[model samples]
Target: MIINPELDKLYNVRAAIPNHTDIFADWEQRSVEFSQNVKGQLDLRYGKGPREKLDLYLASEKNAPLHVFIHGGYWQAMDKSQSNFLGKTFLDAGINVAMIGYDLCPDVTLRELVEEIRRAFVWLWNHAEEYGYDQGKVQISGHSAGGHLVCMLLATNWLSYGLPTDVNPIHSAIAISGLFDLTQLVPTSINAKLGLELEEAKLLSPLFVDPQNICPLLLVVGSDESSGFHQQSDNLSVGWGENFEQLDRMNAVNCHHLSVVALLAEKQSSLFQWAIRHLGS
Candidate 1:
């Protein structure tokens, strides 16, 4: 493992959070219960890969705006199953929710994972009519690595992916506790699993990519998260300047990395309120 002391402390979230395992377990159990209790299509495949599946839950029988969520595990660890609970608040507010899944690293490169996410969106757009959602009113949000992916999605060239040049697949996006620049992580122990070379890391970083459109963006980081996460968000906002129609940044009070994302499950959370307002707009 690469042993850079400063970077390790800044990015090694699991090591810093003593109860991270407990948090994961709670998220898992709650998600499983929520999935069983909620009515939706489960394990719907978006791509041919075994892990390339998503779960969709609509607010009602009517056609509604869609909220797509991507789970974060540094691109190697979590699953959409742990993210199912996030759909409840949005669903309660009459928005349809889709939790996306992608093949993890070591099994597939990070670039491949990004392509899979893009493909998932394309699939969603193609099936929007059948699924009863508004194709034009889609918003996306992600936590941690998923947040990184959110920025990548913003940077995507939809036309190159076969979407018409006039169409914007994403209306707005939220990145929670996201890593924008990945070069710092290369020398850290976290890179041991990711296997990101220096050039690939730079190329994959959202900080370096030119955003494809001027969509609204919300950047959120936990108040108690490490300095590295705060730095990443700050850097990204500046780096992607003027590219987004609206760029708002927030700090989830008294919360750590994992706990901040849990705020989405709380109906009264500022995070959820902001989401509801933007999604309805």
Candidate 2:
């Protein structure tokens, strides 16, 4: 696929951030340290696939709410290991945290990633009791590509997955620095491995899909990110308006794509406070 230079500039997050490498290194170092000390289970298999596993950290309180986080790598990069640092604040707040991992693109299609995530959630719901978390009090959050997955999960028909419609498993969701419209990525270099054609992109786009059940949804983007990202969040906020039981939006000040995820680590940030409030609601 031929890449569009302008579109590439708009969506290529690493190139946009001068200190992306440093940020990645910090995330890795912090995540590794966090994983070593946190009271949790690592690499818990949720499915038969090699990457269909999650790292779970339980709260001190019994039967606490579960806050599942999905890492973002444009659906082609990163994994659960780099995301463990995101669990600490929630864990300290007496909310159980789970960082999910899924197979990357080229090895697996975007559609497959969505399916695997749904399967992961089903596993979590089924085993919530054994893991000491309340299944009914589940909230989800994701960054970038993971944000796209969160929206996809919201659009999923729980009834088809053998879940009752009256009480959906997801109580609320937060998509930080999310890519909602896959169609915009098709011409860019980001879609090389994703191989998303126009029709498939539309089919996979969260903006085009209606939510299967009503749930509180929050859309967040970094103030310094490219217009493409801000548009993505704004478009979804408008497109999914009727589907969300409640909707909220935030622009993390002085932040870009990578730095926004760091706000979740900070206990006092508005992003953190807003997320915790909705998760508890």
For residues 67-158, could you state the per-residue lDDT of candidate 2 as single tens digits?
99999999889988998898898888888999899999989999999999999898888889898998888999999999999999999998
What is candidate 2's CA lDDT for residue 272? 82
The TM-score of predicted model 1 comes to 0.97
Q: What value does the lDDT take at residue 160 in candidate 1?
A: 77
Model 1: per-residue lDDT, tens digit, 1-281? 55789998899899989999998999989988898889889889999998999989987747789999999999999899888998888887889999999999879988899999999988988899999998888999999999999989888888877887886888889999999999999998888878989899999999988999567789999999998999999999998877766899999999999999999999999998888788773
Q: Cα lDDT of all candidates, in order?
A: 0.90, 0.90
Candidate 1: clashing pairs of residues:
none
- Regions of candidate 1 where Cα sits further than 4 Å from its true position: none
